[model samples]
Target: MARWRIWRPRSRAVPFLSLLLLAPLVFTGLKAVNKIGLSSERNYSRGHVTFVTVFTTYNSDPAEASKLPSNVVTVGKHSYSKVGRSMAILNTFIGFIQVSMPRSNVIILTDPNSKLTHGSAVILPIEGNYSRGNLMLQRIRSYIAFLEQRLEELETVEDINHLIFTDSDIAVVTDLGHIFEMYPHCHLALTFRNNKGQPLNSGFVAVRGTRDGIFKAIEFFKEVLEAYHLKYMEASRMLGDQLALAWVVKSYLPSAFSKFSKHEAFTVYNWTPPEGAGQFHGMPLDVK
Candidate 1:
């Protein structure tokens, strides 16, 4: 038997059903933003990700840090590194890939300096300083903040296979043409850190473009954010997104990620205590 009386066509109940179907538009007046035409969104190639390399710099100003040596200065390191990273990416071109803000889905989660435009490249607006926590805490918060925004963007866009999220500190010296390869079976792809059979490191993450994978990524980050707020995790130890990610993967998503070596992925400059100091670093991917 039907859960309720099944109304025949053109019955009194029919009108009420129609109203419920259109309720979202009638009540909320949601104007969906669809500036990108069919060619970009619908057409092109299916199963191929429309690559959108991401960059975020909040409370990351290198000008002040310039006063101190690169190694000693910890604050706003990615901002200064952004100089090289942005340039390297610009110099190298990848087919079917266009780095843009409007399409990439960047939000002003916090206040920041730097104009939206930089010569031919685009920085894309300044907002959100992320001043709620200390400098170290700020990065952890940003890790969550950026994902929340990016996941939202990916959800709307159709057929985006994977989202390549790289830190502003990461620069591309060689051509990233190899990313063109298909990922039919992979859910998540990333580089740096062996993780000892664990998935850690948030510097660069390639989230599986599928809705399920992205949803998992969002949930994982939410856990990190929640831990930060509740003071469950030690702030001093959890400076970057690494520790948070380690916790999330160990506790969840243990089998979801696939790791690539630094040689296969990118390089880190100004790393280690002696020279790069692990502070000012670069990630130049190996492209054959």
Candidate 2:
């Protein structure tokens, strides 16, 4: 009679044990369904008109340029061959992006001596003579000038609203359509590395094409360059373009720059692999 009692209890508990085991599986299935629904909603919310630009010299190597994804626009030097295989790779990358994102635009700025064919991109000849010694600074200045020209060119068109600037070395693995959703109020968005708890990178940035805040930031960068005499020959080299950009925006318009909290948003991937693989990676294309 005691053995019979034990078997009776075990039979009763079997159903309870089975339910407990199945509870987690049921919850996991519902959670996955919820995630799929949310992902679909986010996809519908993606913006359509986003602009991306890259400033490259004629000397950039093709191998480095080939790594750029298909969503970027290439701004190259006048003589395509002079810029070397790197610029050619850049041109090819931009071509791919142009095909993928049909609504996007690519502009290449080159000197009068450039031999590049004007294909799908708008070719803007370098306005004045500038030396290669101050090429980095000059490239920044020319890019701003190119922005103004492109904005004017698109004045009649209402589709383009945001501008994204990326260095040639950066690569995009995910679709960046979400960035356009953060524009206008979020005048500027860029990735930065934590410099011992401070933001330190500026390889990638997004700006509202119509915002005056960017103009103010650019002027501040110019002042810093001029004040330092555009020469970093000193032991304490005046901050590079990225540092200068961060300081100018943080100092002048704190409200404008959106600092990325996660290190993966904009980072030096050479030292450490990005915590998340899909975001973006800013690699150094140059040897230095």
Candidate 3:
């Protein structure tokens, strides 16, 4: 089980609270623009990036979807009909990726029963169940299993440089092959949201394919899994993966993960708009 301890200052209680109040401001200023190591001496090539996402097809009817095995149902809080819409969106996502990065690898982890096809993308079937009640933990477990399988294959495969795990609906506007080269030291990259409830968004995660990078990612996921199981706090279970990830970052490995901002070369944004509110913000034209 994952365990954490908080240290409280006995000598200066008021000062600690004051620092806590000011910590956010300090953190914001420090992380607003991180430009260290931007210009590296080594010239790296455009490496291959493998993009992976979890996708499962379901009937448009809720009743029919419910009849399917619990393991095969869509993992999120969306309705069966909405999940059907997501299937369509994922097809478009795959198409954009193929057009943008023709040489990149796109893999989908879906249920074994899914007959849906994605063009030029490798489909791998997942094992075990994903309960709606524990959606975040179950999703993390599935991703962990997938990473483990890939780690074994990485021993002989040298072509893949980075492994990017994204939500099924995420679209690739351009080739992301430069991310790994830009942030060579980034073993794991996590995107932060403005919301306090769940600050760390797990929808987009990138991990280096090197031996050390994969091991660090697995360790991080294992920590989150253990924290979820141990019920680290009420919010950890209530808010799901994001809260659990926040807790892990707070208690341990604070500097282990790279937190990217929109000012950087590439950053993933939370592009969730209201239903039927089609206001979309495409990638910045200046992004290279």
Candidate 4:
């Protein structure tokens, strides 16, 4: 009788074939898992975000004759004053943009003496006394102080994830939600340069709602203003509000915030209208 040997597939061969078939499956499964994990992580991190814009206006210039859209709040003069008109125009633009964007919350800050309409915008009155001197500088100082005070008040009332400050003269051209998506961890975002290549206009700034290092910035501004006795274009240049703001960022909050270039999204400058697309120039109309 011929010796009968049971022929079995080589154990090594079976294992090798199994691995060959499973290799693609294993890789595909890992890729899917990774994708799901990343998606979940992104969604989880995207917490509730609120958008805010603040404008400071004083009732001085008559150029404030323009009109803003309904959503904007013109906070300065309240009684058809130049500041009111300017703020009105400004608020109009802001209201238009806010309506166009639909997701942002807009507020207008004005002197307590302002007579702004109730529904036009959230009107925040300046609370403390502003010492008389260097009118423009004093106004800027008071505005900044008002902003700080308002921020504190907001914190007390609700949770704010971020705050963006924009001068009435800058136009918004794009949805800024992408910015948050790009730099989710950043505490502040600001425009560093204008379309004309001018350097450092604090016309636009974005800051986290936390008050952690904000007081330091305020202190720096106070020091600059006091030391320079900022007044007049030349004297103000020595320590202008924008310059003081820049100094604070450089000296105190460099790493605490991030700045974006204006060329990236929008344009801001002294508006010379009938000439181009920029905020209106002069008082009242520009204040909104």
**Best of the candidates, TM-score:** 3
Q: What C-alpha lDDT values do all the predictions have?
A: 0.38, 0.41, 0.57, 0.41
Task: After the best TM-score superposition of candidate 4, give how far the Cα of residue 166 lies from its true spot, in angstroms.
Answer: 0.9
TM-score, candidate number 2: 0.52
**Candidate 1 lDDT, 1-288, residue by residue in tens:** 101011112312112111000000001112232332222233221344433333333434434432434534232444325434443443342211333212333222234554223333334332334443444345545545655655777667766554555444333332222232333333444443444432345555555556665665555456665655554345534343456555544343333333222223123211112235444332212111
Q: Which portions of model 3 show Cα errors greater than 4 Å?
A: 1-46, 58-84, 232-238, 253-276, 281-288
How well is each residue in 109-189 modelled by candidate 2, as lDDT tens digits?
Answer: 665454544466666676543455455555566666766655556567654355555554433333344544533344445
Total colliding residue pairs, candidate 2? 11
> Where does candidate 1 have its weakest 10-residue lDDT segment?
17-26
**Runs in model 1 with CA error above 4 Å?**
1-116, 119-161, 173-182, 192-199, 229-233, 236-240, 253-288
TM-score of each: 0.46, 0.52, 0.66, 0.51
Worst 10 residues of 4 by lDDT: 17-26
- Backbone clashes for every candidate come to 22, 11, 0, 12
Which candidate comes out best when scored by lDDT?
3
TM-score of 1: 0.46
Candidate 3 residue pairs that clash: none
Ranking by TM-score: 3, 2, 4, 1
Measured over all alpha carbons after superposition, the RMSD of each candidate to the real structure, in angstroms, is 16.7, 19.3, 10.9, 21.0
* Candidate 3 lDDT, 1-288, residue by residue in tens: 111112222211111110010010112111221221222222242556788887665423323433444445343454334544566577778876766666667888865655656556888878655444444565687788888987888887765567878887766665655656755655666655556666667787777777776766787788777777676445443466777777766564353233322233323334343233453333233221
Better of 1 and 3 by TM-score: 3
